[model samples]
Target: MQDLPFDIASLHAAYESGTKPGDVVAECYRRIAASGDPGIFITLIDAEKAHAEAARLGPFDRVAKPLWGVPFAIKDNIDAVDEQTTAGCPAFAYEAAADAFTVAKLRAAGAILIGKTNLDQFATGLVGVRSPYPIPKNALDPEIVPGGSSSGSAVAVARGLVSFALGTDTAGSGRVPAALNNIVGLKPTVGALSASGLVPACRTVDTISVFALTVEDAYRAFQSAAGHDPADAFSKAVTTPDLGTAPPHPTIGVPDTASLEFFGDAVQAASYAAALDTLRSEGGEIVEFDFTPFYRVAEMLYGGVWVAERHAVVGPLMDTAPEAVHPVIRRIVGAATKFSATDTFNSLYRMEALRRTCEAAMAGIDLLCVPTIPTFFTVADLEADPIGPNTKLGTYTNFVNLLGLCGIAVPTGTRSDGRPASVTLLARAGQDSLTAALASRLHRKARVTLGATGWALPEIPEPAPTLGPDEIVVAAVGAHMSGLPLNGELIRLGGRFIATASSAPGYRLYRLTGGPPFRPGLMRDATGGAIDLELWALPLASFGAFMAGIPAPLGIGTVTLADGGTVNGFICESAGLEGATDITEFGGWRAYLAAATDRQGAVP
Candidate 1:
């Protein structure tokens, strides 16, 4: 077999060391030819054209460009100038005059565009076989469906054809295929990536997604491709931080086991159970919650008003040339003609009610965990019941975009039957980094090789963990340190230890007039104040719980640390200082205790 574990970073390193880009381009073609999988690509870029593009880069320049010399493929639904985009429908093929917004971004970042890969016709199906084009066989097992419409893109990455590929997801096009192929798929928030120049799926909810072997590579590709585009009306110039690791003990919301639907695939059901065990092994807490509201929201996609959006895009073409669309696609899109405007409005109202229920259901969680797909299906199964199994596969995926959440699919392990098993971590918009962090750890825990490739897992430097946006750092001056009674509140809420440091010099501590548990108040003074404090990272999910436990004048607020970093710490309001006796001479809480012990000269 041709090399199964190729990545962009490695290729760039080889190019910088002296290998020619043309040589690597030749290797890509050689691999494509050797794979004997004609279903992988709808239209490949001519080898000669690829070499010409590779030759333009004089030398590898990682500083000026990140993806320099990297090779990648785009789903045919996305346009690439000079390449014909069939979108899995040869009769509807068109030669793109210019690259899609995502393609233009990748080219600017110095990534080589290999070609357009196959997909379900019009980006309509979750099963890979929905197209007239040959179905890209599952990378792990040829017996199973490839999982579409990002089917080819996922398989190419899994087979080491490219380091990463772009796939558009309206429902689960980006995630489903990644799960099927045993790779990482990052579906960013709707407006996170610019969708200009791409064919519309559900125009309002469409996003270009990333498929790569590792979470780091996927994130790197996302950062390069994502940014506000003035050309795209849907694009937003929102602030986004680079991906970071999550603090230990993340609050992961899990669907109630009874709510999970595996459709009688016992192997898949067992795989999911093992995945939850894997999460527990990593120090994550799984909070069980009802998933009915989410399921109701998902139903709206096929049964509600959104199906009309597909009709809106292809309805005209269907009217003009119904024969051109695939028979199944034709039947589905034609159903839109039956719904009147009144039906659309009724769906809109029902969806709003469902959304509220979902919001309440998701009240206090940092991330939601779900099987990437409910189960696996084979090409024969698809042939037997094309629509049924396809819908079942999307049980956990269909409602994500409708609820406005970001998700990343990461392979966890292989089932006993040898098929891949995966899980997706979800977060609210702007929490992409949190999901990436948790997903990467889960990927490593699976201990699986990269997709179908035999490549050993690369040694990735562990990312420094940080608190999420909702989290606030707290300073504990008294008994609330690690391993203490009060510390349990913080730990239960997904808090992690950050650093052990002292406060700035201008602080005074006083033993408050309290009993049973004992309490202390910290006051700021220009002349004298010395209080020792330990910093603990607190996630937003449990910040309120910690705050409510505080008694009297001591409250949570920002405090400057010895390193000049500010975090939410203990602060005393002015009124509490009246009856308190000053103990400013001691530099810290530990020092004050030391003095008291020395003065008494015996253990109490």
Candidate 2:
């Protein structure tokens, strides 16, 4: 088997161990050229320019600069300074002055830009073939359509041409391509990656997504690229949730059998079932839910208001020179002109109601797993019924962004009939880290090799441990510390152990005057105060619920940790500690718990 060290970690290791970035760039070009796949990149960067950029990057230093020496590609629709922004439309090409906010972030993090890859014309269609330029052949099967607008980006990473690539996902463009090519596609929460330099493909719904051979690579790319961009109106300011590891026995949801649309592909259905079984064996609880409302939300995209947004994006371009656009793309974007402003308003009204319905159904599910696409179709099939089969390909995907959710697609297993089968895990917006964690586990569980190159599966990289929405680190100095009786408060809220440490060397712990839970009041002091505590991960939603039940003097607030990470923790107003007993004698929370237990003659 061919050696497959295509993930960012391995590439980083090689770089650190003295492999030159220029050499890797050369190797990448060699492999991409040898692959004989002309459809992958619409504009390949000059080798001399790429190698010069690589040479300029001094050395690997993940701390000072993550993504160091990691080579990546961007979808043509995303602006990369000096690269042609063809967007798969040769007639509409132009040179960009600066990198898109998304690309600029990656470049700042030490990623090298390889070039621009092809996409559906103006990112208008789900089918890869809806491009004036050549369609990227499916990495897994040449006869099949490499699913759309982000098609070439997906193929580029899947073929190991680059460690990762940037793709835009509006209505599954990012995810469908990943599914079709058997790679990881991370469609982060909208506004997570700034869209400043991206050509609008329905500006409201557009997001720059990442494609990589491993979940960890894709996730790391997301972390480095995701941040608030003041210049981009759609950018939102939100902390990156901790992309931590999954806990044992995770709860995953799947659409009920009646709601699953396999489009008569028994092989694909069976593959998904097997994938679920694999997840089960790995200690996941699969919950079945009615997905009708979710599908209804998806219908609102093209059938309701979103098409108008699409039309809004490219209508002017179409009117000026209709011949420049691909026929399928022209038809889809042209149809948007038929809807009136009132129709759009009605669609918006109906969509808000549908979003509520979908959220209600998803309220308790940890993660929802669905077939990335209902079925696979060939180029001939797409040629015969361009829109119908293409729409079917988005059966499990189209509704995600429309309903304000985030997702990551991972290849699961090949269908019995030999086509690739992939699954996407969806969660509410801002739950991106959770989905990535689950996708990482699923990728390892699948144990599939790299797409088409027949390269052996690289060692699954460890995702960086960080806090997630499902967890909030809290510093507790009192009875609520781990293993203490009152610790049940955290446990009941699905909290877990993180670490034991002291507050920033300037806090005092005081035993509250009274109470059954016997909470400790922790406060910052001017001098001679050092309080010990342990940090525990509490689910965000449950943390709010837990906080609501707090009594007077005790509240949730930021605590500066020894390691410099901020965590919500126990805090008390100065007044609440007036008559309290100082308990700084105990070195740490565990010792305090031990002392308390010894005093009671109980094993803690």
Candidate 3:
């Protein structure tokens, strides 16, 4: 039992063969001891308590409890009933009154809590060493700095001390650690998971992220943990779609040559080039775009009004016990005081302009792919120049939440010098399933072992069909897609998303002239290019009411899928072409709509 890998599938296999939950729980502690990394945890649940919880799980019924008997940990900033919520500041520590919303959800799914991991003070740093405690060693290479503020969480999962752990991402805290530690980091849509029990760093953009050995494990944890919490004003019911196949020939956007930054690491640059080649080989159409807007947005995260949000949470602590805060964190969060209320509004205005520019840059791209961290930083290097190295670490990650994007950072392969290499796939919020599916394919292609465990990558089964027997398949290519404005209508009508499917080579996508919620016009044309669309299973009973809501220039028509299958979907009449802008270059309505989120509206 101690020799068994703790991946959900392998653990479940052992359980089926009569392995006991308490034994698995005990083995986790044994491995933690074997690891000899005190920096990995801030507080651990008692071994006896863990065993008791494992024993209380009773029968191994994975159907009712998907995470049954699985061991996991959370960042100290996150609350667990009776555990101390330190937020990495000893002076600010207090006992948690209840389990965090996500913790409760995971516990409900039958996962056993093992401990609270260490992190950057108040989740403030990208380099994890800001903690009052000892910094976690990078799981892959001890010489490298463990990425932060989720350092301990990432290392714990990387070293296989636990199957998965939860970390918080405000400005790259979640992803930077995974890239450094050779693990999968899932930064979910900001509102997808409830934030009721999480200590705020930058409340507007903060999200609790997952660190796991594989994309499958990470996404599975996401499904069990995601839910709409009415108590949390920021929470939203973002759909957790099945990890269906990625669209063939996806239009992937990458940083243009002028925008590529490696800080003089030729090996990192070469590895990224190799990864791009792999994507091309996998049938993705690589399009290069200016990354200047994104880089500016990343700059805004730390250098803009958002810093004031961090100040809001820790100001009182700083006033009462300034010495308790990490010096690096205090300096960074303290800068917020220089700005006035008017300065904040000024930054917000500038932010809107930047967002519009970025949205326009991403107008036609399916998803953006970038190096998880531009280059590596050694512990010695960070110690020599704390601020420079930490600022450099957020090169690719700091812009995500401010832009309302969902991202997953997955290990691609090893670099030339044997350091871990990773890339993050990002899309508009609520499009997590698409990124995960693509990430899964990319991970499988890399053939990398799971974290520091060196356990071979396991096969992830294809997702089951989304349609029910009584449901009729209806295709959507416009705002009706997930996370878009019209998606609510589908949910109200019992529409279940099946998968994102590509159309045959005879369709043209257009942005139809419309109101605040702009709509798309997908039309079949002999000379048109292939486009992407969503498949939804609508009840046969509700089909009539759904069709009745269709306006002029749009009506139900037979749409041809890349697989040669046909389904009822939206089609624009030729008359609609009079005022519509051709958006076929963007490939799909969702891509077109991504820019529409800007205040100036859809700038195709």
Candidate 4:
């Protein structure tokens, strides 16, 4: 076995350079045994079977199978053929006849299954210690409780035992562990990945999540497993947006000072402040919003009727094997029996009202940045007051799924006390790509190593300007460009920045006659100079609506790029150029704005 970086990009590079999959598998087992953590896996796949599967993958072919030859682990609650499907309760364990919908998709994509990882028994607890199995040690520090119920899956990825792993998230089961272990955890939108075979905790809120050493690797796994599943009634055909580039001057919402909670952990609080500063340095505008409504929504997840949904799945088990269930989990889920049908309806109504309030608070905010876990607790702390500490740990996470949001937890940096400092970027459903794009940039900027592996972060390649079949590329020469006053309109319409380029040499730029928020128009001229422009992709379905909003004299027309490519862009009629200022000498709207600002400041 050779020492290898297990990130998707690094491992694929080694595969391209002649490292065989069999060798990688051998290394995986070697690391697992050497890890000295006995609770990471509940059942290991037969080494012979895994090697045979790898051998069958043939030569490296990332195009045909994006996850070809990649090794991964699955939370035990999710079924895999021939493996015992245990929701961490041995009595509830049963042999699976077929793989879960998501599992089968990964298998088809050539990801090798390594084992079934441990989790909170029946996936009921945020603390990993609820399992009948030995607790998985925190990959970063042994004293701290390994965050759960996706504890084992996250620890495996953080410790470099697997390239990635599948974890289930209901109330931050997926993301909390990643934050604790110093890795990436992507909780995609609900129904984005099928939940057909997953042992239900809270069926309505549960989502299959990805844990990886890097944001890029997690997103790759997500893309492979994401799609509609006819077998799952909750599954929808959600399209994963293309993560083109980091949005310029993103408006990030943070908890207002009055609502921020750190649970007395000053180090973590300071770390979060630094993380916000990092975002500010990256051209992000920090907007502090009153988080009271969001906090109320979080309380509702475990405080109200949602807990009854958990009982719907495991009520039979609780009745039959009362003693078999962990005491803490039994207490939590058993409380659901006290709620009346009327209580459920009332709670649902309240939830809808809270959702509206949250939406209003989130309006105009591109992403919400929050401490992944408000504070960290140790095993000793859990033993002292299990429920209280666990509830506090979820202070920032419980409201996400309830609000139908997507989020990714990424490591910011190590705290002053040598603990992991992390923040989760969240957005409304279907904005997974936007959150990921920003998370990836922040993670790289932090310069954190890949989990506990000590491998330097891999260079993120610039995504190419490739449009999905349902998308149309448009070039923005002025206000619609990123960081400009009118850029919000394009973003609201699902437009993503692709790249910055120059128009063909035959084009000239003119500053249209307008006050306040000025607009620029491009036109073709034989002696015109190339003008800088920004390329963006908009959904084909929204193209007509976007074009209809264009005012007279400026309309969508084909414009040639310096790269010899043509795209729909803003073009002005000859009559409209009558009083328009020719700003072609400034090359771009941004340059012209900068010069104007400088000249104003130079006044007496």
Native-to-model Cα distance after best TM-score fit, residue 480 in candidate 2, in Å? 14
| Higher-scoring candidate on TM-score, 1 or 2 | 1
**Candidates by TM-score, descending order:** 4, 3, 1, 2
How well is each residue in 269-351 modelled by candidate 1, as lDDT tens digits?
89988988988887676789889889888877876678888988788878888888999888777788789899988888888
Q: How does candidate 2 fare on TM-score?
A: 0.81
Which candidate order results from sorting by lDDT in descending order? 4, 3, 1, 2
TM-score of each: 0.83, 0.81, 0.84, 0.94
Query: Quick one: RMSD of model 3?
Result: 7.2
* Error at 26, model 4, angstroms: 2.0
What value of lDDT does candidate 1 attain over all alpha carbons?
A: 0.80
Clashes of each: 4, 1, 0, 0
Off by over 4 Å in 4: 241-243, 484-486, 505-518, 523-529, 551-553, 573-585, 592-604
Clashing pairs in 4: none
Question: Which pairs clash (backbone N, Cα, C closer than 3 Å) in model 2?
Answer: 242-467
Give me the candidate number with maximum lDDT: 4
In the range 1-604, model 4's lDDT, one tens digit per residue, is 4568899898889889998999999999999999999999999999998999999997789998999989999999999998899889889889999999999999889899999899998887777888889999999888998999999999999999999999999999989999999999999999999998899999999999999999989998999999899989989777786565777667889999999999898899999999999999998989998999988999988898899998887889889979988999889888898999999999999999999999888776777999999998999999999799889988999999999999999999999988888999998787788889999989999999988888889986877767888989999988788766677677667777777888989878888886556887888998888888888888888898899878878999999988897999999998888888888888888788878779897311
Clashing pairs in 1: 507-529, 507-530, 508-529, 532-589
